[model samples]
Target: MAADITVIIPARNAAATIGAALASLVPDRSLIREILVIDDGSSDRTVAVAVECAQRHGLPMEAVSVRLDSAGAARNVGIERASGASIFFLDADDQVMPGSLSLLRAALERQSGAGLAIGASIRRTKDRPDKLKTPDGYSPDKRQNTRRYLRNELWPIAMGSALVAKWAAAHIRFPEAIHLDEDTCYWTALLARADAVTIEAPVLVYHHDEERMARRFITAPRGTFLAIARELDRLATAGVERDALQWRKAWIAQRIARQLIKHRMFADAAGMMRAVRAHKELGGSPKALQYRARIHIGRLTGIGAGASPTTHPAMPQRTLIICHDPPFPPTSGADLRNFGNAVAAAAFGPVCLASVAPWNGDAQPVDHDIHVTALTTDSQRQAASLGWRRIKGEARIPRPALTRLKTLVRDFRPDTIVVEGVALFKLLGPSRPLVRQLILDMHNVESDLADQLPRKSIWRPRFSGVRDLERRAAAICDRIWVCSTSDRERLRTLLSKPVPIDVVPNGIPRAEGIPTVLPQPAVSDGFPVILLVGHLGYEPNIDAAERLARTILPRIRARLPAAKLVLAGRSPKPPVRALAGLDGVGLVDSPDDVRPLLASAHLCVIPLAMGGGTRIKILEAMAWGIPVIASPLAVEGLDLTADEEVLLADSDEGLADMAVGLCSDRARMMRLRARAHDVVWGRFGPRAIRDAVRRGLGRNDAGS
Candidate 1:
């Protein structure tokens, strides 16, 4: 119990919070004789604050200000300066919680068996001290007992705010650069050489300020993986056993995957794909490998089909691109911009995208990269107004017209013809045996949508026939692709096909991978900017906008007194247009760009109460590193947690409260942003997705 405990705090400008952090050390003042504050080139009164705080608290604290560029360097400076039997790293923005020092000291006393003692931190609200926000629990203390931790919330072993033996601390120092998750590198380094112990008690209260919190949560995960790769390189330098080191890397990769999934960062599909690849490099187990694969499959199925067409770079692969609309100019969510991109990405040699839409007189410019062909037939033009569709009477192209497609089929000579819906399959003549592959990209189950309509005779029969054709098409196709597993399983039960069904999810084009750093928005321009991004042409999006304007925005404006709603996306129809002139609603119609607007806004809102399929807007917002508040249905396919990355609600009042909660609590907003980015980079990055695509394409690619 009489072991030395060195408290290492890497402080930047801590004039505001250092006193309280130092004051919290009263319990173990005698035992914790060495408290080192590594001040990394502070421009503020941090050194003076630390000195005054130490004297006020009646404790011995040393402040060393090194002119270094990053916090990681500051941590290393503390490690070198400390001479205690144990070491504990704390952040400048956070305060040491009650009983943390004593508990950490006691745990480190038994360091002969364990290298470090890890503790969890609960995030505190910036405005309201009464509200304890964002509590993260650590892995269970029982060593090698991974069962209980898996069943409950378990934080991974990271260096910041965690206690470690001085000897272990000396051996494993923080990387000198990288403002990001430099801690992960240290964690991996420690885990490789030494075993860890996790304490369940709260030890730190991470103050979720705008600047630090946003960078830490959203941008850090990307760099964390980059650092992990660097750590692997370091292991190589240190001459550690390749096999053992790889296992450690795999363990880290697994934890990262779990964290990403837990937060439901739908955009992180790519990162998950990379994790699977990294795990394989580390000699991963079969179970470990499947973790990301299953997630990839889940995300793929969530988007239904015909969101983005993706293909591996190699192999003599053939692809079919299908879309609900003409996809030219790609204005809508399921448009040709994404369709053409996917087709090009998926096809190794030649690709053809077939679409169905209302024929307008305007000439549509087609992309030269991928072959674009439209088959706009009369079946769609037979306006079946609101549930008037009859099963047998459901319009299909006449037999004579079906024969005409033979010429188009003969000319194109496509190996696979990807159809967006069953109607296209019905239009293609059955006599043509030349087409080797028939791929169906079922964007949504027709019956599922029809079932949502008011239960009526016209609706049921029409839906029933559509369902039958859906099943019939499945039997003939070589492979069926859906957006979510929900659709796949639902269709599997309907289809007679023995053919394989897979998911090729919709994906956001990798956004340059650049962090857009902007000054925090104005606090009092009489409007706390509330942003909603999505095409208003969609029923669900329009419904969400209506609800927010009518119900939620008023409540938020009343509470905050300066709240404003920013409606952005393509095509605002008459009803959506009316909300713009309303008191708090500010509409930006069909902006060629929405990213810069999203960055400037205070909060992104997704109050969707209706519709299905994954909302890529949520994913897109997350990828851009913005915090979002969405309904449970809006985040249906995503792995999101309540009060974490998103705030889920049903009622108008509930949604209004969430807006107020996010507005009042900047720390919570920052925490949500961090969690959002972690979900995105961890689950949906391009690298991860590319790997997943390779796997889905029969594991034939070299990357796989």
Candidate 2:
């Protein structure tokens, strides 16, 4: 018999992999009508490789290149040109099993008038076992089958795993708008109209990569979720039994709701729960009943699942702020930024801080106006932060806090949510957020910082997930805030979509009763104190402190034996404390104030090997009118200039030399102190933060 199946492979920059995909189809050449390799504007040798491989294998292949930029769009073009009665969709990077396509073709041909044939496929993921994925055989009941496809992962309606009739392909095209999961939507829609038969024959060798946009579950915007829901809604109205369609929609809502609830994103979850409840078919569902009971108990307990929270006159707009550390009496650099940003948000309207506080919990009495919800105890937080729970790139929350958070969201529906950093992002859940405005504050372009860190072989894969975390957070957020233009530029490429990125430089509050000109340190007459200030528990600080004590301090002592090095900050780790045991290094552990250390220290040396963001400790030193010598990376985003406001050095020997040089030169010390203070007071102070917050909130307000 002449070939009757047209295989379509939509490729984009797949030069290295497309040949294997083409070669896999050679055995079924007698059954294939033609092969169309649609190259979607490849800047590589995708077309050339496809053509070369096709000729070598003696397979009928046509190479077509166009600037579609979307795989769905490229597939649609291939569909338009296909001549076969049955259409097989293949990805450029994946391979088809030799006999599976033959089995699939026979299944459709055997089942009289069947429009689709489904086969098993094995998904190959990195460092994981190959698992067989086969669809549950189709039944006469369309609604039941549809529901099963939506609910069960094993019953997948995957593109390469299923072969559909040419008519069905023409009737239902792939959604071109979304960057990911276009195939899922396309298959679901086609499966709705076509009666499919299944065989447990493996067809596709799907290679899965977590970084692939199509496989990523967490980072999509609200528009992407809406697009999926809207299509399902349309399918519900379009002859595929409404019950089946509605059930899938409701199930999707519940899935999203569970994620939202898990993260204590209550308002968003409430909205999703309402959608789930709308599926009248799900009225008696255990999940549905559970959602109903929560809302019922919430209302009785005065936490009403009210409509969107804006009817109250007191709050024109509500905001929710998230932070993993304490937000009161800001001690560390992170603490100061989180607290400052929260205070700024509180000024415009009501603000609620969701503190994922430490195991011991926050000690400060947060008695002020803004409501604080302590979500976890030390045990719960530790349990939630475990490696197993975070493999999927989302932070887990305990069951006990879900309702409390839902109650808060139901009662206090925030119009905007300010996620402090990527540290707590996983706790925000896995799908599109329901809040009107979502803002991400980047203290460090954390993914960039992570890339710079030296990792042990065993820890490499786990730490690599940080990029996914940050990228996914960026994908969901409406806008992003960075500390510097350099950070803004580096971070833009990491986002799944282009969001408005604003550079909100880090700043410190102007201290009271401080003289504009600081007096020269008593270094010439006494021991010279060279300080390195930071949250000593932090990895970068720990490394820098250890290096200074073990290496740099000894070099400095060789020139000037009286010079002493002090590591000052909150929460000094064991390694940092060990620095004090060294000859000239002193450890200031968990100081209530660093002002005394700054006041006495003649020169601050930050000889960091790897760090991120503008060093806030450097700013604190400058604000106290102290001279600083830091690595170039430490001085990033700050207005301080090397050889003028601050001294910059990349090497430990050079840092020690600068410290020794400054000890005797009181005139140079005076000049650096005065200049550095002016830079901080004039460029980096409380006013900078206030202005940035107002601008950020104001833009959202205008848009709303």
Candidate 3:
């Protein structure tokens, strides 16, 4: 019998379960040639257990002892002494599934080339051991497979599932320095020189009862990350995908930075982060920029909170805004409002913004013409900790981002500094005397928002400290800009200070700038479509969306069967996302460009139970010549007359009936659309808001 397979296991101190691994080979013994257990400094009775198990199962086994302390080095020894033509790498804590060996062997024999045969196997997670998860991105095409692997879209190719020909295996070696993901390096090397076929059958199971990679990383965090960086560099050199590799490097930097932080390896972590900024040239990469920004944030907090005193050589006067989140590529309601203000501020000069960013791609906010400085992702995380906020009595911007902002402040040399949102005004407290005016832009009355939310809401405002933060800002500002006179009145009462509040009513642009109309949609399946647009994650928006889908949409659809309600927005919460599954309800989620949806929509509906800010969505619909139907609260800030500029209703039944009436009455719809368009065009347009911003800056002249 020609049993030509050799199983090489590099193990240390694994005695209890090595017998199961040996027994798993017994059924396929006719195919197995020999087994090599390279004991890499094992203190337990591992060698004896392996020998006894192999002998008991009638399989030839070799026990080789080495004090190398590295699994890669022991694996190298296994390669050196292997007698069989085909070599399979297994771990002491893992085993081949029942039919996986025969399947892999057959797959190799059937393939055109003598190379690597990979089985679809699993690395069993600790919490769910019995449930096997098949590895993803297993295309028969090797090039696509490798690309997917580099991008991390493909799950890890476990070592136990790989069976490489001995001759091809001789060409490459496992990277001894990399303790984690060493097989990835070795397998990628093999994949380059030799052809590989991925078998569909299940092959191996890697159990997590043994020490996991995350726990092992606590010991050599820096070393592990550094090693990964080196391998990434090599992959980049080999002409793998540029963007994917860059993202991988930046993600690795973030991982290593956290690890170092956990182990209190500050100096090394800082050094590593700096090295990435200097040499990696990842300025355009959003993920990398996030890591670097987090590094900057560290310059103001915990250990690295001090910096060498330096100021910029005086730059030309510009308006700078310190906001909470990025304003570019305008995705959410905050982004839309911030973009409008930034545009208005830019009439002075190119405005600069300092905003928060996060580590994951989810929080990636891009820079537009207004040069934006990124804040650490932790700014929101730390700032939003309700318990921490209660204990500290106030939330402060992360020190590193604040320090970076100070540098930007020096360099930008703003005569007018507009601090957007109350959450971020803490950084601009009287450091440099060069600034002429400091304007506070109030987006909403936080106390009003707090009052509007249900008691059970986790975000329900417990802002005893937040009240103080606002009052403190009101006490020391040149002027305050509120979106509506209602918010102005609320602030006047809450702060009880004569801080000259200006009603800068939030604006939407005229249709001349953006493509006003997309080509009409071909299908009328969702005819007389009623649209609701906003950031779906916000509590008020979530409540409104759920209410419409669950209660109001059904009523409207019952009257006009083809009247479909469309909820379109960014970052939808679960309740809002769930609305899409309901009959007669459509959801357009996180669209890259929402203009098409807006242009094609027939009617805009806003039945909000809770809200504070002026609805930008209402203005957008009016601009597109679509009639609006909203609850009184939804239309609170806008200058619209009921049944004239827009239709208004307070109850769900009333709102649904109003929507049905508007869908059937084209003439009335046209009149409301025209009048509403006039309101937005006259009072809430770019030109009008610019004039208001100019007045707020105390400039009656045309130029800055």
Clash count list over all predictions: 27, 1, 4
Per-residue lDDT, model 2, residue 46, is 92
Q: How high is each candidate's TM-score?
A: 0.50, 0.51, 0.52
* lDDT per model vs. reference: 0.60, 0.69, 0.69
What ranking of all candidate models by TM-score puts the best one first? 3, 2, 1
Q: Output the better candidate (1/2) by lDDT.
A: 2
Superposed Cα deviation of residue 63, candidate 3 (Å): 98
RMSD of 1: 18.6
Worst 10 residues of 3 by lDDT: 307-316
lDDT of 3 at 695: 75
The candidate, 1 or 3, that scores higher on lDDT is: 3
Instruction: Please write out the lDDT profile of model 2 over residues 1-704, one tens digit for every residue.
Output: 56999999999779999999999888889999899998775657999998899899999999876544468878888888899998999998899888777889889889886788888889889879998887765686656566666555336665688788787666678866455547656766666677778887788889877433221222221333455566666666545566666676677667655544443345545666777777777756898778666655554564533334333222234567777665666677776777666655554445777766643444532322255566566656545342345543244555434445555665667677777777666545531354667788878876677667788533235446687788877777788888888898888777777888887776663233233334455344446788887888777778888888898889888888887888878778788887788887778777877677777877778877776522877777787777888888888777567899989888888888888888778788888888887677656654456457756654333211
Q: Against the correct fold, how does model 3 do in TM-score?
A: 0.52
Q: For model 2, what is the error of residue 598's alpha carbon versus the real structure, in angstroms, after optimal superposition?
A: 1.8
